[model samples]
Target: MTLLSTLNDDMKQAMKAKEKDVLQVIRMIKASLQNEQIKLGRELTEEEDLTILAREMKQRRDSLAEFEKAHRDDLVEKVKIEIAIVERYLPAQLTEDEIRQIVLQAIEQTNATSSQSFGPVMGLVMPKVKGKADGALVNAVVKELLNNL
Candidate 1:
């Protein structure tokens, strides 16, 4: 099933099971998906759905980091759970090693021998890794590789 339908089914199950946290997260996902559809005036593709899920996961991770810095363990734990729930709908993420390999290839393809080529290299790489890798991780890898050149 598509992520949207799976999410809808899970939402209903969460409600029936009285899983408040899970239901709340699912509702948030549904709302985001619906809003995107309305904004674009079309239904989302699977890739688009994955992109939205990734964005939600990224937001939760950012919140988790801030909560940790503030020593808010309760809020941190809640955000961690929310991140896990959002992750259920995303594709398997690329490992750092995998991302590095792709970045290396992009660098070669773009003939990017220095940090000056960061923009072109990233433009070439992001599309290949989008939705499957974190932008921060990709950026770091690109920077490290370019510095070594």
Candidate 2:
């Protein structure tokens, strides 16, 4: 099933179950997707859907970090839950080791040996790991591997 259909079904279930948190998160995601669809003036492709979902995940993570720094335990916990819910829609995430391997291959493919080549290496790796891994994590791995070269 497409992401929208899955979200709709899950939303209905959440409503019947009276799951306030889940329902809220699902609505937020649906709103984001619908807004993007309207802006693009067409149905979103699977990749576009994934991209929007990933963006949602990133925004939540950023909020989580800010909440942590502000010492707001209540907001921190709620954002964490939201992050978990957002994760449910994303592809299975890559392990650090798996991401390392992927980055290594990308470096090899691009013949990138230093931080100077960071752009090319990142360009090569991001598409391969897109929506499957966090961009920040992949970037850190790339930097560590390349700097050691």
Candidate 3:
């Protein structure tokens, strides 16, 4: 099933189960998906849906960080639960080693010998890593590789 269909089914199950937290999270996801469809004036492809899910996951991670810094353990726990719910729909994420391997390959393919070539390598890398890797991780890897060059 498409992500949308699976989400819809989960929404129904949440409603029946009277799980407020899960239902609320699912509603926010549905709203985000709907907003994207409205913004583009067309249905979303699976890749587009994955992009939206990733964006949502990123937002939750940012919020979690802020909550932690503020010493709001209660809020931090809540956000962690939300993050878990959001992750259910996303594809399996790449391990650090896997991402580094891909970055090395991209660098090789793009002949990225220095910082100047980082952009070119990233352009070739992001699409291949999308949904499976985090941007911050990739950026850090690329920076480290470029710095050593």
Candidate 4:
């Protein structure tokens, strides 16, 4: 099944099982997907769905950080659970070493010798890494590789 269909199936299961937290998270994802579909006037491709999932995951992570800083362990735990749910829908994340290797390859392909080539290098690399890696992490790896060149 497609990712979207899997989500729909899981939502039905969650409802049947009376899994409130899981149901809530699934509803949030569905709402976001629906909103994006409306905005674009088309059903989302797998790539677009992954992008939305990543964005939701990022939002949860950011909320987790804030909750941590506020010492609200209860909220932190909730956000963590939400993050876990969101992560289940994302592509397997690329490790730092893997990202670095990809960045190196992008630099080579772009013939980017310095930071001045950041834009072109990112343009080339982001598409390859999208939905499989976090943007901030990829940017750091690219900068490190370019600086070392």
Candidate 5:
């Protein structure tokens, strides 16, 4: 099923079950999707949908990191739960090793021999790993592998 339809079903279930956290996150996700569609004035493709979902995941991860740094346990706990909910929708993430292999192939394709080639290597890697891996993690991997070259 499409993300929206799945969210709608989950929303109904959450309401019936009175699961406040799930309901709130589902509402937020639906709103984000609807807002994007309204902003673009077109139906979003599946890839665009995944892009939005990935952005949501990234935003939560950033918030989680900040919360942890500030030692805000209360907020940290809440954000972690939200992150878990977001994870339910995302595709299975690429392992570090899987990501490493992809980065190696990208570096090979671009003949990237130094950190200066980071941009070209990343350009080649992101599409192959899009929605299946975190951009920040991919960026770090590219940087590390290029630095070793």
Candidate 6:
């Protein structure tokens, strides 16, 4: 099944099981996906759905950080739960070493010798890495690699 379908199924199961936290998280994800579909005015392809899922995951991460800084452990725990739920739909994350290797490959492929070439390198790299790698992590790797070149 597609990731969206899997999410729908899990949502139904959660509802049936009366799992409040899981149900709420799934509902939020569904709303996000639906909003994207409406905005695009077409059915979402699997890749588009994955992109939406990734975006939702990013929001949860941001919320988690804010809750932590605010010293709201209860909210932090809730966001963590939501984050876990959202992550179930994401592609497997790339490790730091793997991301470093990919960044190096992108630089080589683009013949990027300076920070001036960062955009082109990123354009070529982001599509390949999106959903699997964190954008900030990838940016850091690119900066480090380009700076030393």
**Per-residue accuracy of model 1 over 86-136 as CA lDDT, tens digit each:** 877777889999999999999999998789999999999898887888899
Residue-pair clashes per prediction, in order, are 0, 0, 0, 0, 0, 0
Give Cα distance to truth, residue 134, candidate 2, Å: 1.2
The lDDT values for all models are 0.91, 0.93, 0.91, 0.89, 0.93, 0.87
What residue pairs clash in candidate 4, if any at all?
A: none
Per-candidate TM-scores read: 0.96, 0.97, 0.96, 0.95, 0.97, 0.95
Off by over 4 Å in 1: none
lDDT of 6 by residue, 29-116 (tens): 8888888889999889988987888888888898888999999999999999888888888889999999988888889899998999
Question: How accurate locally is residue 13 in candidate 5, as Cα lDDT from 0 to 100?
Answer: 98
Ranking by lDDT: 5, 2, 3, 1, 4, 6
In terms of lDDT, model 6 sits at 0.87
Report the lDDT tens digits of candidate 4 across residue range 50-69: 88888888888889889999
**What is the alpha-carbon lDDT for the whole of candidate 4?**
0.89
Stretches off by above 4 angstroms in model 4 are none
The digit string of per-residue lDDT tens for model 2 on 15-95 reads 999999999999999999999999999999999999999999999999989999999999999999998898999999999
Tens digit of per-residue lDDT, candidate 3, span 6-53: 999999999999999899999999999999999999999989998999
